[model samples]
Target: MPHHPAPEETLPVIALNGPTASGKSTLAVDVALHLAAHGQPAEIVNADSMLVYRGMDIGTAKPTQAERRGVRHHLVDVLDVTEVATVADFQDRARTAIADCRRRGVVPVLVGGSALYQRAILDVFEFPGTDAAVRARWEARLADEGPEALHAELARRSPAAGAEILPGNGRRLVRALEVIDLTGSHAATLPAWTYAIPGVRAWGLELPRDVMDARIAERVDAMWEAGFVDEVRRLEAAGLRRGRTAAVAIGYAQVLRFLAGEITQDEARADTVRRTKRFARRQLGWFRRDDRIAWLAAGDPGAAATIAHDALGPDALTTDAPQQRCGGGEQAHGQRR
Candidate 1:
């Protein structure tokens, strides 16, 4: 690591963003290696909210030690399943991590499937203040009348927020209702684009819709084969059911229902795939609104090279690196959908 950062006011943050099953982990590793080998040291900082929880490895598709390829990753597996992962908290920690890496003169590679999290970090996004009483009231109503009832109220209050949040998402509905009640309006589910720092570039990778859908299904199938049910079973034993955020995670939620005899295994698998694909589409839609992103087709040859050059510039790899830093070549080239 460098003893001091370069004399820039702000370092550029390279972002690898895509939907579920987009293979962002593999692509990010490849990009990091390419940067390191060329004299620009870089490290990955996870932006996915789900990736924060430990014991969520298989379902979240977290990279194993082998897949990390010796690169240091920040903000991955830093939270227990019982701890809540909120955007405000994540924003502070992620900003600190990015600043730390920049202080060491290492590029911060932001990668995740959560579009909201990404926008919160890179853009001038501030969360609405929450009131305990307001939240409690909405949560109680959600428990009594169900999520759809509150969702209807949200729709009546703020049509935009209502259209964005899913009706089945009781947690989000409660939050939205609370925000509307206290603030007189609810912001859109995803933040509007307004980057906080200059030169922060997001690269969007996507496949054809059909291929992406198939991959989501296949990934969910692989998770079950890899004992996802067993993993969730262990977590439930460890009190995952009591965890607000972890309990509602994509595969974990569905599988937990299956384990409780609320649904069949096949239903769990199908719902997992369906919800994941829906999430992917939403991610793509959210990213599409950001005109600064340089969209790239997934599996494109030399795409990693493109991101590396765009991030570090042509002189970074060719010219001698600035005084400081430890550092790679490309490995696997997978991307998120």
Candidate 2:
């Protein structure tokens, strides 16, 4: 297979985004290999927030080195466990990586579950400036009243932000409230879903609700079997508890509780499964809102080929005008409705 045209010659990015356990990583490698065979060499640029941290291999479901099939990957294992991952920081780094890949005459396949991070890279979105005092106040309130109380307060102030943020996600909840306090609103004031970067299109991997739930359960079970707790223990020694963002990753949070003896192993397992399913559902909801994404069923054998066709075929993948809202044309390709 010949390498696809250079970035200037064609689309610069093919984003493979989906919920956890949707096989995006495998599909990304498959797409890259397929592209390379066609002479369109491609590399993977991770967009997952947690995957940026090193020593977070198993629980984050990070692809193994062998699984990469010798394809170059960017943005994985770049941060120590003590570092914080911010969307703005990620946007700068990921965009730079994508550009670097293009300069090297390779396609940059951006893949991950973080909707906002993906958007920050591809959309004309800017984060609100944060005030130290405002953030501190909200952080202190979170410590005092707990996440549930603060989330309720946030719901009262900004219903949209509240609905979008998980109650247990104290960090994000705090940030949302902080944004609200600083900007007088959250999310509403930001730019609508519009691709700021040219030559990019997102393909979403989806499965039936039952299939997705099963995948989540199965993945959680495999995580335990793969010694996810042991992985967490190693990361804790690397100062995971001090790492604001990495410490709260789904499995890490649960395992931390288990390590602290706050919960039994069985309880941790059960909670991890339940929280993962809920997180997956939330992920679907977030991705579903972006009409620009072309959905493809995860179970379809032809899904990867369809994605390749969409990216490399004659049809020009277009985005709506920046001023236009994204509320239409969200049809899933290569799957039954």
Candidate 3:
């Protein structure tokens, strides 16, 4: 019997993205295992924003070293909780990891729920430069006047930026206003930013809202059982406070409320579920707006792996394969509204 040829292989930078509690991590791990079984081991790169911060484990749902199952994972737990990590930083780090994987003949698998981080890694988005003094000024204003007032000011200065920014998203709102103050140009008209890196095929996962909510609740319970409260307490003991990005993370924030005695354990659990659901919704909304993401259903990991393999092909496993170049390539992949 003549053997059928495998699908024409192309070197792939597989980006597996989805909303919170959408099983992206598990799916990616399964896909990596499948590829390894097929003699093409994948290097899993972390793309979730909160996962980048060190000392944030249980709440972030970071995969344990054992769970990695010998697959090489990169770009996770690389930054201090106090240090700020922008999308540009993620793009740079992820590109380096992908390039390194390619050099070593490993498939690059970008996996996580952070839509902006995923887009920054795979697509072009120019982030305006920041001035510490200006940022400090804005931070002061944010502290003094609150997010609502700052949002109102942003609406007046750059409605385009304001419209895209959620009122509660203080980090982005401050960045947008700071850009306007520094560059004298609207945040929307900045030059396109591209990662000086090769291309990769990206895939995203989609789950039903109700199903995702249920999963979030279950995951929150698991976290609590796994000592998520102690994890938050440890961070607090180490002087990590609310209003910081790490503290704002879904499970962490809810736990902090519980620690403060502002909410009961039941309320904390319920709030974690609610906040995670909202975050997941935002992530879905962000990724769904991008057409380049080949959306896969939240089903069997094997099925997801099959879809990813079918999309990326065997060529993606080849080392230093010549990448196909295209114009507006950066814009073509991750243009989320």
Best by TM-score: 1
TM-score of each: 0.90, 0.89, 0.82
lDDT of 2 by residue, 1-337 (tens): 9888656546558888988899999999888876776567889999999888999998888999899999888999999989888888999999899888878878899999878788888889888898999889988998898889989998999888888788998888888888888878897435787777667768888888888889988998999999898899998888999998998888889999999999998999899889889988888888888877887778556555556555554342333111111112123322211
- State the lDDT at 22 in candidate 3: 75
Candidate 3 lDDT over 1-337, as tens digits, reads: 9876332223567778888777788888787777776677577999988888878999988999998878888988897777777778778888788877877777888898877677677765667677999989998999898888999999998887676666767777788888899988665433344433355566677778889888888888899999989988998887667436776677777778889999998898887787678778877887777676666677743444454444355354332222221122223443521
The per-residue C-alpha lDDT of model 2 at residue 207 equals: 85
Model 1 over residues 267-298: C-alpha lDDT tens digits?
A: 99999998888888977887877766667777
Better candidate number, 2 or 3, judged by lDDT: 2
Better of 1 and 2 by TM-score: 1
Candidate 1 local lDDT, residue 20: 80
Instruction: Put the candidates in TM-score order, highest first.
Output: 1, 2, 3
Better of 1 and 2 by lDDT: 2
> By summed lDDT, which 10 consecutive residues of candidate 1 come out lowest?
323-332
- Counted clashes in each candidate structure: 8, 10, 6
Which candidate leads the pack in lDDT? 2
